[model samples]
Target chain A: NAGVTQTPKFRILKIGQSMTLQCTQDMNHNYMYWYRQDPGMGLKLIYYSVGAGITDKGEVPNGYNVSRSTTEDFPLRLELAAPSQTSVYFCASSDITWRTEAFFGQGTRLTVV
Target chain B: EDQVTQSPEALRLQEGESSSLNCSYTVSGLRGLFWYRQDPGKGPEFLFTLYSAGEEKEKERLKATLTKKESFLHITAPKPEDSATYLCAVQVESGGNQFYFGTGTSLTVIP
Candidate 1:
C-alpha cells in the first residue's frame, strides 16, 4: 500500500535556515505524527494531527511547526534551524483504533551546521 | 509525567543464544504498549502491540509479553540477521494519543 513515505532522506542546513520535511501516507489513517530521534536516545514527539487541518504541539515542539492540509499529507516545518535540531526525523500514521500499530516512513537525517 | 525506560542499553550474543529485552513504563493511563525493530538508516518497523496485562504476541523468533507495569520482548534462538535496535513505546489514554518512547536496546547477534 506504500504505507508511509518521506522526502529528502538526508539534508544539511545552515544555522538560521528554514526547511520542511514532507510526509505522506496512503493508508487512510486519521492520526499522523512527527518525531525526532537523537543518537543514543529515544524518539521524541514533535507534533501531531488527528485529522486534516488539525495540529498540536508535542513534547519537543520548540523549533518545529506542522500543518495537515489534507488527509494524506502532514509536513513538519523547521524555522530558524539550530544545531540542536540535528537528528533523524520520522513520520508515522495510524488508524483511530488504538489496537492498530503506527506505520513509519524511512527517516530523514538532518544536520545543522 | 509519562515515561518509558528500556534496558540494558545494548546486548551482544551468539547466533543461537536467547535473551529478553525489558521495557518499564509509568503513566497515568496506559492505552497500549508497542515493540519495534529498527535497522541503521531506516525507520522503526512495528513488531507487536499489547493492550492489556497478560497479553502476549509473537512473530517469528520474537515474542512480546506485557504486564501491569512492564513489557518484555523475548528473542528465541536468535540469528545474526536479527541484529538490530529494539524500541519500546507506550501510548497514553490522555493527551491526544501521544506516545512515550524509550532509548532502544541495541542487539548484536554474532554468527
Candidate 2:
C-alpha cells in the first residue's frame, strides 16, 4: 500500500503566492490530518477530516484551508503565504477511530520569502 | 487546555548507554498515548501505542510505559541508528481523531 503520499516535496513561494499541498492515501482510512512542524518544534495540526466531505479546524489553522472531497485525498491550501508558514508540512491518516496509529507522509518543505 | 511536556529537550549518549525519556501530559478523558520517532527532515514513524495507565509496549531496544499522568520511553543498549527525536502525543477520547504532539525529545547516540 502506498500508505500516504504528498507532492511538491519542496516549494518556495513569494510573500503573497498561494499553493496547494497535495496528499493522497491508499489505506482507505477514515481520518486524515494536516500538520506543520516548525524547525526544532513539534507538529501542530492544521486541519483534519473524519471522513470524506467532513473537515474541521485543528489547534493551528490560520492561513490555511483544507478540503476532503474524496476518501483518498486531503489537500491543504495556503493563502498568500507568509514567512511564518515556512515550515515542513506533513500529511497523515488513520483508521475509523482515535485508537489507532496515524501514518505520516514524507513531508513537504515550504519556504516563503 | 491540553498540554504535553517532554523532558531533557535533548540528550547525547555514547553507544550502549541506557536512558529514559519522559513525557508528561494533561488532557480530558485520555483516549490514548502514542510514541513516534522522527529523523531529520523526515516524517514521524509510529513506534508504540499505550492505551491505559500502567500499559507497556516494546520494540527492539525501545520500551514505552504509561501512567495516568505521564509516559516514559526507555532505551536499552541504544545504537546510533536508534538516535532520533522521540515524540509523544495524546488523543483525547472525545477530541475526535486529532493529536496534539509534544515538542519531542531529541536523542543522539554517539559512537
Report the number of the highest-DockQ candidate.
Answer: 2
Candidate 2 lDDT, A74-97, residue by residue in tens: 999998999999999999999986
| Model 2 alpha-carbon drift over 4 Å, by segment | none
- What is every candidate's C-alpha DockQ against the true complex, given to 2 decimals? 0.80, 0.84
Q: List the residue pairs that clash in candidate 1.
A: none
| Cα shift from native, residue B55, model 2 (Å) | 0.9
- Model 1 docking grade: high
State the lDDT of candidate 1 residue by residue for A1-113, as single tens digits: 69999998999999999999999999999999999999888999999999999999988999899999999999999999999999999999989887678899999999999
Chain A TM-score, cand. 2: 0.97
- The local lDDT score (0 to 100) that residue A61 gets in candidate 2 is 94
**lDDT (tens digit, per residue) of candidate 2 on B4-106:** 9999799999999999999999898888999999999789999999999989999999999999899999999999999899999898866467888999999
lDDT of 2 at A23: 100
Candidate 1 residue spans exceeding 4 A from truth: none
lDDT of model 2, residue A15: 99
Model 1 residue B15 distance off true place after TM-score fit, in angstroms:
0.9
